[model samples]
Target: MDLERPVQIVWQGPFTLAAAIASSTAPSKGVYQIYGQHIVFGPNSLLYVGMTDGQTFGARLAQHRDRWLVHEDDVTIRLGVVADLDSSARLADIEALTIWWHSPPYNSKNIWTYGGGPLRIQNLGARGRLHPEYSSHWKPARTPPDGEHP
Candidate 1:
């Protein structure tokens, strides 16, 4: 989506997996980040970034509880609740941008192919291990084929 205004996300939490799954204050739909030890990235590095549109954060996080609970390095989660725009598409945009910028290892897809127009985002509050601002755009190089004139 072409976002004319910067999307503002107010991040909250560094909650344990159990706490996040039981958090009553967490937003029902938004982006989230998981941080924990990584073999290459070491301890407390961002591991995954995800979003939920139809499910509550508790429900969504609960789905991954088993995997995150297995980590020994104190896995924590952060929730990014969008300020004004709460559309699923906007949530997806925020999720994609966060993943693209951080390159968190657990996120295998959408690393290079977050296909959307230019966007601007402002991160507020406790944004663990994420930049305060992000600007995303994709412009592929184009060359005229066989003697095309400019």
Candidate 2:
């Protein structure tokens, strides 16, 4: 193996990534959330939504590498950082938006269920983009009083 030459090593695994602050709780108090795109490599190539409040792009990636846990498959991941400094919210909105957009199956994390039962699970891996909006297990809550934070 030559050190100077690039090598291709493939593996699949689980990841416990430590993300940089996606959106600041306080837009005025903190750096406005910069919306951007990053890349992730694994047995399954996934493009996820991400935003940050700081400039520790490389370090944030390093945290992903360090915390990721190998599953039945060995997976390697990489991220390319971009910025969108106009919004107060972080990547959560994008995550939900994309999950509803793509609807990929077998990816359960997108369901965002804290754990209840089958009714709580959702089809997260939809490549064809069919968002029918099923599951009525949860109810919507009314907004808090004006100028009040929930």
Q: Give the whole-model CA lDDT for all candidates, comma-separated.
A: 0.78, 0.30
In terms of lDDT, the poorest run of 10 residues in model 1 is 138-147
The segments of candidate 1 whose C-alpha lies over 4 angstroms from its true place after superposition are 1-4, 138-150
Report the number of backbone clashes for model 1.
0
Model 2 spans > 4 angstroms off: 1-44, 47-50, 69-84, 103-150
Q: Residue by residue across 1-76, what tens digits does model 2's lDDT show?
A: 1223211111111232333323222122111111122233334434332223454433444444465321223332
TM-score of the candidate numbered 2?
A: 0.31
Which residue pairs show collisions in model 1? none
Please write out the lDDT profile of model 1 over residues 6-121, one tens digit for every residue.
Answer: 88888888888888888877767789888998889898999999998877888988888765557547789998888886467777777887777777888976665555557788
| Model 2, residue 81: C-alpha shift (Å) | 6.3
Find the candidate with the highest lDDT and give its number: 1
Kindly provide the TM-score of model 1 when superposed on the true structure, using C-alpha atoms: 0.83
